[model samples]
Target: MSYPTISFSGGSIDRADYIRTDPAKLEELKDWRARLVKLDGLDPVLTPQNELEWGSLADCPPGADLVFLGLRDGRACFAAVPEAGDAGALQMGSRARAAMGILGHDDLGIYGMARSLVDWHARHRFCAQCGAPTQLAKGGWQRDCGACKAQHFPRVDPVTIMLVEHGGNLLLGRQPRFPAGFYSALAGFVEPGETIEGAVAREVLEEAGVTVRDVSYVASQPWPFPSQLMVGCHAFANETELTVDRTELEDARWFSRAEVVDALTGAQGAAFTPPPPQAIAHQLLKWWLQR
Candidate 1:
C-alpha cells in the first residue's frame, strides 16, 4: 500500500547522483528520452499542449549548460537555460502557483527544483572564498573555484510555520501584505542556533503574545520562491486572548472551530479564509480540523 505524499513533494524521479558523476553515464544522458525544463528569465516555458514541455537533446543549443535533474519513468530529465542567441519562440510563463491548475504535482516539484538551482547558480557565479570565478560541476549540483579549490552547493533556508491552539480555539494572524480577511498560521525563520520547537514558540509569542507548549511536527514543504523549506507544526497556546504585535501582524484573534469549519467549507457568514492547498499551511489547517 502506498501512502499519500505531501503536495509539491513527491515525484516519480530518481536523482541519479551516482550516474551524474560518471563520464560514460553523462554521454548516455545525452541520448536518453528526456524531459527538458528551461528557465527563460526565471519563468518556465510550457507548450501549448499544457504539458511540462519536452525538447530533444539535439535541439539544445551548442555549449548550453545542462544539468541532469533525474530519471522520470526510467528516462532522463534535464534542466537548462536558453541561449541568448538561440531562436525559438520560447513561450515564457509564470511560476508554479500561477499556473498550478494545468501543471502536475510532480511537474511543479520539478519546476521548483529547476528554478531554485538556476537561481542559485546565477547568484553565486563567483566564489565566496578567494573571490574567484566558479565553474559549474557535478551536473549543476556543485560549484568549484579554481583559485581556492573551494566547493559550494545550493543553500536552502528553513522556516517554521505553526498553528497555535488554546482550548477549542485556533490562533491565526495576518501580515499587512496579506489579502483582507485572510490569515495564516504564524511563521518565522529558524535561526542558526534555534531548534524548530524553539522557533515555533518564539514566533507565536512574538507575533500574538501568546505562550505555547506541546509543539509537534505536522509536515514540511519545499517552498522554492528562492528556496526555502517550510517546517509545519502545531502548538498549544497557554492563553486565549491575544496581544497582537502591530509590527509583526496587522491583527490577531482566536477563532472557534465552527468558524474555521465555516471558512474552510465556504459556508454562509464566513469571516476569514486560510491559504490555498498549494501551501503547507493549508495542510496543517486540514490536519487540525480533522483532529
Candidate 2:
C-alpha cells in the first residue's frame, strides 16, 4: 500500500550538509537574513495563528548556543538551545502534544528537527570520553572535545511499533500512564544488534506473550521526544492466547475490525480511545485498516 503522509515526516527544508561541513559557508548564513525558530526553554514557541514562530538572531540572548537548522527556501534557519539554568516548562509534554495537533505536517517536521538538535546540545555539554567540556562544531551538528579530541553527534534511537493481527482481529494494549480506556499499538526500543523484524517479534512476545511472524515494514515517523525513529510494522500472531505482562501493560486484548473502526472514528460506545493522529500507533492502525 502507498504510505500516507505520516506526521513529522514531510518538511520542505533542505538540510544543508555542505554548510555544516564548511566553516565559511556556515558563517555566511549567520547574517540578519537568517531566521530562528523560537523556543520557550525546551518547548516550542508558536504564533497566535498556531504556526511555528520565527525570529532573528538578535532575539537570541548573547552567548546563547545557536543550532543551525538548515535552510528554509534558501534562507538559513536556526534554533537557540535554551540557556543553562533555565527551568524546563512544567507542562512541556501536554503543550508539545497540542502543538503537534495544530501544526501542519511540514511544520511539525521542522519542529521535530529543531527540538531534537537543541535538546541534544543541552544534554551533551561535556565529553563522555574525557569528562571535559565540549564545544559546538559542524554548525551545531557535532560537539568537539578539545581535551580528548572526541566527537559527539545527535542520536536517534529506533523503536519498533507494530500492530499484531490474527484471524482478522488486531491486538492492542493500554499502558498504566495512558488515559482511562485509551489503547494503542505495542512498541519497544530496538535493542543493540537486533534487526527491526527481530525486535518486533521479541517485543510482541515479551509484552503480551504472543509470538508473531511475517513481520513487514510499514511507514515510519520521526518522534522527537528526545529523538526517536518510530519504525511501524505489521505482524501476524501465530496464536491468539495472551499472557499480558502487567508491568508493561494494564491489559491486552484482541479487538474486531468493527471495534477499531468505532474507536478511530470516535463513534459512541467505542471500545477504547484510539491513539492520537500524531502518534505512529495511530498511523499503524490506519495502515492496517487501509490494507
Candidate 3:
C-alpha cells in the first residue's frame, strides 16, 4: 500500500504553554509597538493587523485582550495580545479563512492557531459558575469571575477522524453540505465519557453503519474552528457493508486504493477531490494512500 505524505514535520512543536504565560512583557511591547486591529462595520470581521500605532489608550478591561497559541519549533507557546474586538469574529475581516481552503500545507499552521485561540476567548467571556462576567487574568490564560471568584480556562473539543479500510479498499462518505461528488473519511466529535478508540468505533457505526476493529492512532491536528483537536486514526473494518444514515451522510461506499489515488490526484475525474491538506481528514487519507 502506498500512501501520500502528510506535511507534518518532526521538529514542529505544540505551542500551548507559551500562550498561557504572563503577557506583561507582551503588553509592554504592544504599548510601545501599538498592536491593533480595526473592525469595519462588523458584517464580516475585518482582517487582523499584527501591529498598529498605540495612541493614548484607556486601561483594558480585566479580561478584554487577545491570546495567541504560538507554535515555535513545533511546540505550543501561549501568549496574550490586546483583544481589540470580538475575538471570535476578529478574522472575519481577514482573508485567512478562504486562504486556508485554497492554500493547504503552508497556511494551516498560523491560521489554525489564530482562529482557535481567538474563538476560545470569545465564548469564554463569562464565568460558568456565577453569572458575573469574568476578567481576563493570568495573561489571557484564565478568566476570573468577580462575583463568584471562579477560574475558567480555555478548552479544546476532541474529535476523531478515521480512515476505515477493508480488503484493500477504504470507506468514504459525503455529507449534504460537501461539494458535489466530494467524499472523505468518516468523522465525528468524541462524546462525553468516551475514549478516542470508543469514539472512532461509535462514529463509524453511527454514520456509515460499519463495524470497525483494530483501531490505531495515527496523528493529531489542531482544528481551531471554534477550538477542536482532531485525532486521526486508522481502523480495520470488520464488515464492508455500508448502511448510510441519510440524516448524517448523503452517500457512503468503499473505494479501491487505486480509485482513491486517482481521485486525489485529479486523474480519475475533476469532480472528485479531497478536502484541502490542512484538514486532518484529508491528511489521514493521504497517509493511508501512501501506505
Clashes of each: 0, 0, 35
Top model number, lDDT: 2
Ordering by TM-score: 2, 1, 3
lDDT of 2 by residue, 1-291 (tens): 756678888687888888899988888899999999888876678999888999999999788898898898879999998754223421246688789889988889999888888888988899999999999999999999999999999988999999999999999999997899999999999999999999999999999999999999988998887778999999999999999999899999999999999999999999999988888898788778888
Better of 1 and 3 by TM-score: 1
lDDT of 3 at 263: 79
lDDT of 1 by residue, 42-74 (tens): 666677766567776765657767777888778
Q: What are the RMSDs of all candidates, in order? A: 4.5, 2.0, 5.6
The candidate 2 region of ten consecutive residues with least summed lDDT is 83-92
Candidate 3 Cα errors over 4 Å, as ranges: 1-27, 31-64, 68-94, 101-107, 268-271
How much does candidate 1 score in TM-score? 0.89
Model 1 segments more than 4 A misplaced? 1-5, 58-63, 81-95
lDDT of each: 0.78, 0.88, 0.64
Write model 3 residue lDDT over 1-291, tens digit each, in one string.
Answer: 544444322223344454446466445534433322221222112234332111222322344464534444432233333344244521233454454444335334544555455556666777788678887765556778999899887777888989999999999899997878888888899998999999999999999888899999988876555567778899999988888999999999888887878877878464367776656788787788767
Residue 239 in model 2: lDDT: 100
